[model samples]
Target: MIITTSTAGRCPTCGAATVSVDDAEPWCAGCEWNLDAYDRQRRAPEFGWAWVDRWSHRLGYRLTRRQFTHLAGRPLGTGGRSAAAMVTAGVSVLLIGAVLALAVTGVWLIVAFPFPNVAVLLGVALLGLAVALRPRFGRLDPELEVLSADRAPELFALVDEVAAAIGTPRPQVIGVNGDLNAYATAVGLRRRRVLCLGLPWWGALSPPERVALLGHELGHFGNGDPRRMVLTQPAFTMLGSAADLVRPVDTVAGGGIIEMIGEALGKAFQWMLSRLLFGVHLVLVAVALRDSQRAEYLADEMSARVAGIDAATSLLDTALGHESVALAVRREMRAGHGPGRWRSAVAESRAAAGGRLSLLRQLSVREESSLFSSHPPSGLRRRMLAERPRHDPLVVLTEERAARIDAELAKEYEQIRRAVAWSG
Candidate 1:
């Protein structure tokens, strides 16, 4: 006689009633547990999947199971090696090139019979010195701690979550006393590391806003280009320093036959080297900047995926407004037009002009010289994000929730301002 048992029952753990059992033992094969024990474990938090769904609709594409897997499981350095490895490789290449150049020069000098060994030696020494100093100069400064003592726990939790999501190590957190701004620095492996959140950031931003900011920084970690900055930046600095040193030496030393020959060769070699290095640096910087910008976009998407797009957008807007107000105050001080009264006047002017201009553009134009811009214009960034497709499921909910939050925050801010004015 053959006995076949039907599989059926409710899972006590997750509260789904399609559980199965075999041989008189209570079990849920789907959830992988005995029905009795499964019922005792608490349910996980509701993921707010409805919000995510609405966002997916707004984004114009549903995240299929495969896509979701890709998002969650994809390594930070998906396309290639990590930033640290890339930097190490670049420096290695530079070293190899220097060695090859010296080898060729030595061979030519030996064969040609007329060339001075001293000149070739000097060239080799200079190259060696530059390579030797590369690591020291390239390393990023330690990140200044930016968060207040009180907010450290919250900040760490956010950093951990974002880091885990992006599959990069959580960066060292630092508190800075500055009134504005947060940045990541690639100080080399086992060194200062990434993600310095400003204290002002904590005071100014809400919890969701802070999460958005962390997502942005995580995007940087995901791209792994910060390490490139750590690697190449020192070479550029050393090259510039070498040029400065050589120029002054040539000027002070009169052109005796040896000096004249050395000067001529050195100047020519330096000129060509400078141009070549500068061109290479420029290309690399441009590529890095483009990647950095895209990283920001990706981060925004991730933040939306986790928290909701409206939260990310609101965070951007608030950060933008804070930046604008700070800029206005700085301009007033710089123009010798301050005394608190002028600051107030400038703030009023900024408010009247509206806060819709691209923050990235404003930051680049106002803060960075053209020679060292590591980011694209803010206007372009804003336009890209604004136009990009969003997930649809969370669209209505995200927009509605964001609007309500914004309105409430605006009211509170207004009241705070009024109270400050009254006190003053």
Candidate 2:
């Protein structure tokens, strides 16, 4: 259960210490923050779209997980297994393209020309096959601002400390961005390890929580998840690329009777190809998500070992409570006034919301593990940590060092925010 402070007593908008509670709705004497009124707006009572969207995602995720578990036994694989899966997927797409080419050639000969026009039929067939088989390699750019050791020695030093504590190699590269998330990913065909830290998310955490979060991301590298994902990512992209090459609705119609007949045939062929590709895409995603969920569990355990269970649990709480309080913080930040501290702002928003986190945690427990999600539910992670033996904190943060680190990165955070917005 989420232990919450008393609500109907404080103002969310203006950071007012107290509000008058009249008829169950608290009104801020300091500002226009009315708890009941803001809650209604935040929840979006109109049309119930939020609940619908959430339920739809949950349903799809549950089905995907079920299908994946039935097809592939638990603990999907190491990097090699993922690579083999991608190779098989690539070959399957190529084979489908070749079959489609032959089918197209036969149809063109029967419908367009009275006799066999060998050269033209071959040209059409080859062109269609080439189009279907073409690969769209993902973009190489990291996009976010890359931070080198020279530029941020203190941050790198902290990362090194965390890595040493966890017995993992330090990330080769570091990038900073605006997201409320931090992750370790392998980039490019070379599989370069990149540690991406989101300043917004880091700024929201306490010093101990920061250690837990950073250790968790670094753990992904040692856990073998990043390498596996890098290998399989291109294959998932290929499925979408193949589907796009023969999308049924993208076909154009011409005026002549023969042209119309050809268009209809093309549409039918495309429709069949799309359905086949979509089914393959679904299966591939399910397998990928299964691996992702396991990777997260392993990574979380590493964090628990490196940063202590209390810190890990606090990190999880911050992550779960983030979405609930994000809007209120955004509104406050947008008005030129400032809460100045993300953690305090979140706490105030939670108080205003009246322990809605208890409800969110309950929902998370009730919802089945999703194949569409990269991480397991927060409640599940918390429970797993609770069952594990406690360890001493690996890297304790002195107040002086923590404050100095924050001081150094303060300007960099602003720069990152501007860059993200400008890039968009």
lDDT of 1 by residue, 111-155 (tens): 555456676566556555545434343344443534433444544
* Candidate 2 residue-pair clash tally: 0
Model 2 lDDT tens row, 43-65: 32322476754554556445534
Please report the candidate that would top TM-score against the real structure: 2
Q: In candidate 2, residue 236 scores what lDDT?
A: 52
lDDT of each model, Cα atoms only?
Answer: 0.46, 0.63
Question: How many pairs of residues collide in model 1?
Answer: 37
Worst 10 residues of 1 by lDDT: 38-47
Candidate 1 — what's its lDDT?
A: 0.46
